[model samples]
Target: MKLVKSQPWRNPDTVLAQLIQSCARTRNLDRGKQLHAHLVASGATPSTFVANHLISMYAKCGDLYHAIALFDRMPQRNLVTWTAMISSFSQNNKFGDALRTFSSMCAAGIKPTQFALSSAIQASAFFASLEFGKQMHCLSVKLGYDVELFVGSNLADMYSKCGSLVDACRVFDEMPDKDEVAWTAMIDGYTKNGSFEEAIVAFRDMLRGGTVVIDQHLLCSVLSACGGLKAGKLGRCLHSCVVKLGLESDTFIGNALVNMYAKAGDMESASSVVGMNSHGWNVVSCSSLIDGYVEMDQIEEASRAYISSRRQGIEPNEFTFSSMIKACASQAALEQGIQLHAQVMKTSFVRDLFVSSTLIDMYGKCGLLNSSIQVFDEIQHPSDISWNSIVGVFAQHGRGKEAVRALNRMISRGNKPNHITFVSLLMACSHAGLVEEGLEYFYSMNKTCDIEPREEHYACVIDMLGRAGRLEEAREFIAGMPFEPNAYGWCSLLGACRTHGEKELGELAAEKLMKLEPENSGIHILLSSIYASMGQWEDVKAVRKLMRDSRVKKLPGFSWVDVNNKTHMFGAEDWSHPQKEEIYEKLEELMVKIRKAGYVPFTGSMPCNLEESLKERLLHHHSERIAVAFALISMPATKPIIVKKNLRVCVDCHSAIKLISKVEGREIIVRDNARFHHFADGMCSCGDYW
Candidate 1:
């Protein structure tokens, strides 16, 4: 705004208006205020046109207070004046005020311009006010602005944000000319509303139309849909498109690409995207990588990513901490989880609902139920997720009664138990052998809670009955299921049959499992174990031969213990550890002591037809035993020995651990694939049920 220093301007008001527009464009609030003062001091009443620009300048400068004051003082306001004020409120996130102003404009018989209607529609979208949005749509139609590209695009956006995709699509289709913004709104709406398939279809249609130029925003929305569907092939195709479009350098596009690749389980591609991104990793990209690694059960990689992000000065937000904690939970890495918990406490996310719930779960899975309870108790206002996590903690620890009490408490706090709540509840009952209570809860899922029982709920019931040794009832329940029983149901029955030494039924369950999952090594292993328990060497040989013929390799069972912030893993009879001599010596010493305490090695299911001494030797050297031995040698006696296994603890090892705990006078907690076993005072927490 160069001043007219040479002579007085003939059209001073016009020059002032132009200067005010310049100030608004630059967001120069100080200059805008100076011009306002000049207008007041010149003793000339500015016309409505000039006044409108002043209002716009103030609004654009973010001085809403002055904008509103100026608006209130303006005795004559036209469409531009009202539009500027309404847009100001909308832009500043004063959504309710924007809508109110829109209403007042309507009451004043002021027909809104496209800009005003778009701002009001955006406000409605932010509020998710479908009814108000519909009214706005109607007004746009009545004012013959519905077909206007700007207003129609906003209408579609509002509908989508309100979760009314049908209406959004209708508006989008009725538009005379759909631009990139309109198509982007519809696609984004579908993606946001969980209609991933529909979103993809719309994106395809937009591309097929070929009239609208695709932009980064449109690509980002479609990529999100691909991620949701885990459509890796399509995601790769989009990656190629991004490269060709030269949008790969864009920060937002880079973040979206990382998220898509991560969600699609292509961590290699995801990591490359992060590396290739010119802007480098931010919290969003780093968190997505961590989450992807966790989902793939690569806890070590996830932890490394977390550490690398921190080293690069990227702070972990709630999602990052949550994913890392979840990774620790998956591996039962209690020490690492504890370290993450401390880190979370240092950040403001310690009290975040998702992070807190993840912390509770990590503690519970690591066999620290007390820590989980403490975390839950610290939550100021527990959400359903947090409540469910606490209940799940009790369930994981086999505390059925406490889980029920937690559920009651959750309900009392006005939080409804969702489907996840009942899953944990049913699991608790199953682990505790509360058969009747488990059945009651399973039935109550649909009757009382309005949550239709999913397949997982039915599987829990079967598991409950199977764990109670009610094989006949469990079979009947499966037979009576409305839908075909899934693999979990059959697996539960087979496990129970193996536990109770029911050879014929175990064989039958194995047959069903073979048809359902022909390559499942666990089924073959379980069946072979059942045959071995019955001393049927020929049948065991047959199963082993079938595994070899099908090329189905059994996953080797291993146990790992964290000592001094490092993990030591062991397999059955493993001699791979650097301290194998010490571990074995300690294990042999403990075995001798446990045997003195009347611990007899139970090798009924040792598959190999070997001498009694060799079988007993094999049983004594199971992976969990080796892990516990290592923990006892390396960890302090005051600390409980926590060993995590990839498979269920064998009955022989379970018995030996009970006696070892008593003889050594040290608590040993073994977390296997199924559940936790707290061995102390010559007893197990499962009471020998597991």
Candidate 2:
């Protein structure tokens, strides 16, 4: 601009021309107007090409009105002028204006070029105007732009993106020489349109033609297709190819690599890949990692990964926060999760809906039901996510009555319940021992709401009946289900037999449970306990031998208690604590008080061959009771004692704890594997059924 401004003999017309070229390139509209004024003062009328450049520049700068005005003022227009305007509209996402401009250009008898055709076709795709796209295809053929490489590619891309695979393929086949981009577009279109078989065929065809055998983008897309089509073997083959091709360094490919392993049920390998690429922990990558950890129930590892992300200064986004919060709830990391909630507020995600939902779940799992309710209140207009999170919290924590109340309110507010919503409701009812309400919701799931019950929903119903002591009804429900019962299904019935001491049904259930889960020692222990409770020592010994033969190991029991905002965990009779001597002294005092209130040892479920005195040793030293002792000693005299157990508590502990809660005049809430047991006033929430 300064060069044009300083030279007087450079000629005003030539100088103004050079300045307009610079302004158009830089999109300096102010300088462009100054250049135009210089040209008009020199009595020079701008040419068609100059006017087109001005229009293109203004349109590129998002000044659509100025571009259209300049084009209308042009004394003569060419294909270049029309294409420049249409391309600007398409790029700005004003697809409707682009199409109308094309129509007007044609009405004025101006022929369009390959550039015009591509821009118009792409605009059709932007708007999903499939009919208009077809019209553009016809116009391109008549205008002799169909043979151009870019024109044909745009046509295929438009049809493919518009979800018309047939038209996209027709355009692809008509092309003279299809490039790699065309092939990739066609393959993606095939997959997006559910023609996965055709997609695989296209990939193979590209390979046979000596095209690039493997690239990061292509492999990532094809691996995702394998997951969608459930072709695990093919996905593994792709993984081998990716490794051999040395494209594993690509972050997108690496994330897909982890996801492919997890989806194929090879979580051990998935973690290996995730471990090698710590920097690959973006929102998508971390989400896949957390999901895999959750799938394998690797509770602690999930929390560690979340902590690692925070330490790396890669502030967790919504997906990372949502998935990590879910893992925290699963692992019962309630206290640590509270800090994450505060961090979420300081970050840019304070108003995020998914983040709010995850917080609801976190507080809910920790038995902070009121906190969960408060988070729900903050949601401006709660959607399914907010409803499901709060409802699932109650359901998982055994607050069945409250969960139903919330569901009714959600429906009243015109929020529809999804399959997961009903699953949580049934879980709540199962834990609450509400047999009639559980069955009613289960029946109405598919009939009224049109949400078909999955295996999990059916499992909840079986577990629901079992919790209510309707063992025969549970058996009947399994028999009447549309699909064959799964391990969870059989496990539900087996749990009932163990609690009710139904020898005939217990024996039948053990047989099925063994067949379904031959390697689950918990099921073997469950079977043995039922036999021992009924005084069938021979059957108990036989069940023990079966477990020994199978070589299945059970997870050790653990318990957690919160006191003065500090969580204390005890595993078994762990006696190495710094305050072990004082803890036992408090335990002894609690034991004597409960014993005077008619408490007796019920150790029929113990598997060890112990003397009469030793049986009571294992019963009283149970982890839940030990954690309760710690809670009672540390908290105020009448403060509610909250204990969380890793597994379902034995019947003896359940009854003894109820007496302890009454004697101490404290409300003790114990969350076990199945449901919460609120022991107050000498009553268990499960009514002794669990």
Candidate 3:
């Protein structure tokens, strides 16, 4: 420093003191070296204070090699010197070195300071080693540093990071003086562990205590909790607090606000927050908006926002590309996704695990399974998520045996199969009607893989058994479940019963479903359809009465198809299209051709108790049928038609589409609420398994 150089009249100790302080503050390594030379020339005994400051300066500057060299050459050392070196390694992302240095300090018989203890505990968290963290806790207690505030806060954080939330809470509870940093750490720990409600509660307690200063970091943690819990009212309250506290101008706080509203499903508020803020869009803001749109199923809006953001000069990161590509998958816009894929390949982000996995999902959802496999093959050291994505795509495409082979391969490659992997495998077997195979996999989950079957796995097993006309065994399996079956398990059984014409068991499963989810209109509708299929008109009327009494309404079925880069949506009996007349005419002609090709009007799946003529007429107006009719009129017959539905395809429409696909000599791909169905030459990919 010039201040040190100009002080020639000052004593050597005073000059060295000033220089060390200046170097530590600014992390000026060159000046620190010059000062060290001056210290040597002065011939003064090198004080531990001066050495510690020099080491801290080097460590803070990320020159760990210099810091370690200085430490090793020190004639004497103190707690500050050891702590400075450990923190240097910790801050530079060399967590293993930090831990080893702490060990060396202990072996050197130097008692640790509170700062050293905190840095060592934090390094354990960064390492994500529970054993090391517990050892640190034991050491903290042994050395009488466990009760210190800084050490306590770090212990809480370390436990949470190691997935020991209970111990974290215990540490927080045992703390005597919880300052702002301590409280913030606890709240963040709760949020990190998915204890959103507890995080909010802690925030409320912190506010009521009024002893700590609430800063931007604290506000961001609470906002994240609100978002995770979907507590819109609380989130709005936090928004007000941000305004009152004058934090609205902060870009990071603004990003948190956007995330809170987006995760709360209030995208209108989220977009308005983004628009009103003067802060320009960054990667986080753009990614938040795109991800929110995808979560809301607003694929078109996500596309527009992505394009607009790129025009505004904000480069998309891996998260942004992943969200946008998933939106393309949802829209089944294969061409748009391909263009995005090209952009990704041009950049280094194509190698990112999330982006690559999303590419596979996009191709699979768009019915480009070959392209999906190609992407899978190109990935280097694919994570379990990548493997699961490819396996899921195969399952969705109705390739059960191949999916099983992939699962085995994943295991052989040393990637232990998680619960999600088995879920994919069981789903594949269900889609392919492999009842026995599904059963074996379900059992193997616990016996071989040591993975417990969650409710979804049981649902798959039920669906598999029900698909094969083994409704009785499916019921027995549910009764024998280790835990109470969730609503999905019962709903799957009901759907299977409806498919297999097991009216009695179907009624039982529907009753169970209604009791578990009385407000679910789909369950009531399924029950009504089951009764109608059995020619029980009175039961259908009773179910309808029950629905009316409960005031539960079914979601109106709608189907969407993309053509020429534009998406068009159609609902049952829809007449809002400008080409309605032409669409209706095409539908009539197609009906005639399919009828001539031995396609009978099937109304057994319709829930309404009406005359045969009216039922058949109503079936013709189903949303998917209308969407297909419109597609046939709007596009060439040689190109395949892909339609996405909001609910399961009715049996009548499915059968009708199969015949139409054969008669029109066109391939028709339909994605219902559950899986994809590709119909060609009067055959469906599901092979009537569903």
Candidate 4:
């Protein structure tokens, strides 16, 4: 593999030029060094022309040290030499060096060409230096190079990177000719700024004009824009283009296709793309599938996908692990979450910002607050997300004062509180019956933190006041909002009304909520509960009949318990368990003990009017009771029982569980849709506020 010295000498310059080109293309560092030796032995001083090519050759081969040394030794410097050096710095991710080199070139009284200016603009964009980018733009305008295709595209991208989408669009509009590069830059800018509609418009213009060829990269960006907008029709159009261009085998496009379909909620298409061998499924494709499944609330399916990913050699990356952890949190799978944490600790992603934050959330949702606190304490420098997660966990567990203290510490560390931080703080105050503190924080949202309150913030305020039994004040606050309250606001008031036994306000809130969210069958149940509380059996029957007429079916209440590393699910009056008879017998014995301890079942909890005996029987067989019965019989008395419920615990069950916890001398942790309830010694951790 050695180069011959005695070669044709008729055209020595052309031969050396060809050799350098060949070396640059093939990245043959050895042959490139040999060519340098031949140049030195020929006794011909390297001209500016030959030196420029040598610098470019070394730079393209990824040998930046040699490229810089050769450039410094050159007796002469030209525009191409400066451009190549700047590009070399940029390609190596040394953006600061690239900018410094450009300054040096300017000090030498050299005029920059279009390519040199473009490289400097790109460096500014990478650093997101808005002022520096403006200076470069002014210089380009003064030099009459701003209109050039290469410089124009770089300027557009630079503005976008600085988060100035308006300026980016203005620069794009000023360009005389629109090329594929220009279109791609504009599309990327809109997508990055969350202007999905504008991005779609620009892409449509590109297709109608037909002046520029749509390359795979341009199409990829547009597909992402479509996904953001959930424009599945447009995505299918792009998919067709991908097939027509025969770019289906391209790995990057294949991943984008899967992501687009997943985000659009077209799971069938996304799964099909992954299943096709021609699409070249990789780690990203599988990760997208997992995320999509989580978004669809298919936690079990997401877990199966994670297992399948591990069976293959494709190791899960940060995004993969984070998505899987979220799935576990949603399912309340504590054992699986602990296993995943062990796997994460073996990799560097355990310390990653997103993975660490997600781990805290997963542990908190699993009723493992100690583990959550440990994860939070171990973070060397927590970001806003980490702070929010810790504060939220404390709030969710009914530790309101602790959450407030954590927020104070977060601010003391020089981290500014955002809207999400305020939300967590407000929710904490609400759950702990701190109505005054919650109101103070809600009012301070705009004045102190410069954060305008959104609908969610207003909803939190309504919930806090309502939970405190201030029903009239809550209604007045809703009436005084800048805009009509959303469904969440009305639903919060409805929940509060139900809690405080205000049938009139509850019915009004239910009317508004029904108008906004007619398909929400949970609203009907809440209204029925309100009527049942007032002894209006006919009104409850009417509500039930309306539901039946409309075919509105409520989600059945389900509970899950993990024992011996296996999760068991139970539905209302479920008798499918292998030890159903034993569970019932144990429940009967517990009922006797609870009755002797002054436990009386609240028959009003039943929405339907039935015989007193029938209502009591139905209340005895609720899903949570069945799950608790199984846990009490299966596990040791010293161990605490944790049950996860899909719906809120009814008043009858909540009352029964409290007495049972005291009778059996066991701690029971129940996590419903909204928050955690810890029952011990005949008292609930929520303080009966929820």
In terms of TM-score, the best-performing candidate is 4
Candidate 2 Cα deviation (angstroms), residue 19: 10
- Candidate 2 to truth, TM: 0.76
Pull out the clashing pairs in model 2: none
* Model 4 weakest 10-residue run by lDDT: 1-10
What candidate 4 gets wrong by more than 4 Å, as runs, is 1-11, 589-600, 636-640, 658-667, 673-687
Residue 69 accuracy (lDDT) in model 2: 81
The digit string of per-residue lDDT tens for model 4 on 1-690 reads: 123255654366666777887898999988998898889898988777778788888888889898899888888888888988999888888789888999999999888888889989999999899999999999999999997889999999999999999889888999999899999999989998999999999988988998889788898889889889888888998999999998888877888888899899888898888877644457898999899899888887788777877887679999999999998888767778888899999999989989999999988877777889999999999988999999988877767798889988988997788888888888888878888988887887799778999888898889888888999999899889998778877888898898788989899999998889888888999899889878899999999999899888988999988888778889989999999999999999989999998899888647887899989988999899999999999987876688989988877888889889999998888888766777788877665655
lDDT of 2 at 659: 92
Model 1: residues with Cα > 4 Å off, grouped in runs? 1-14, 100-114, 129-148, 170-176, 576-582, 592-598, 658-667, 673-687
**TM-score per candidate:** 0.91, 0.76, 0.86, 0.93
- Which model scores highest in lDDT? 1
Better of 2 and 3 by lDDT: 3
lDDT at position 500, candidate 3: 76
Candidate 1: RMSD to truth: 3.1
Candidate lDDT scores, in order, read 0.89, 0.79, 0.86, 0.86
RMSD each, Å: 3.1, 6.1, 3.9, 2.9
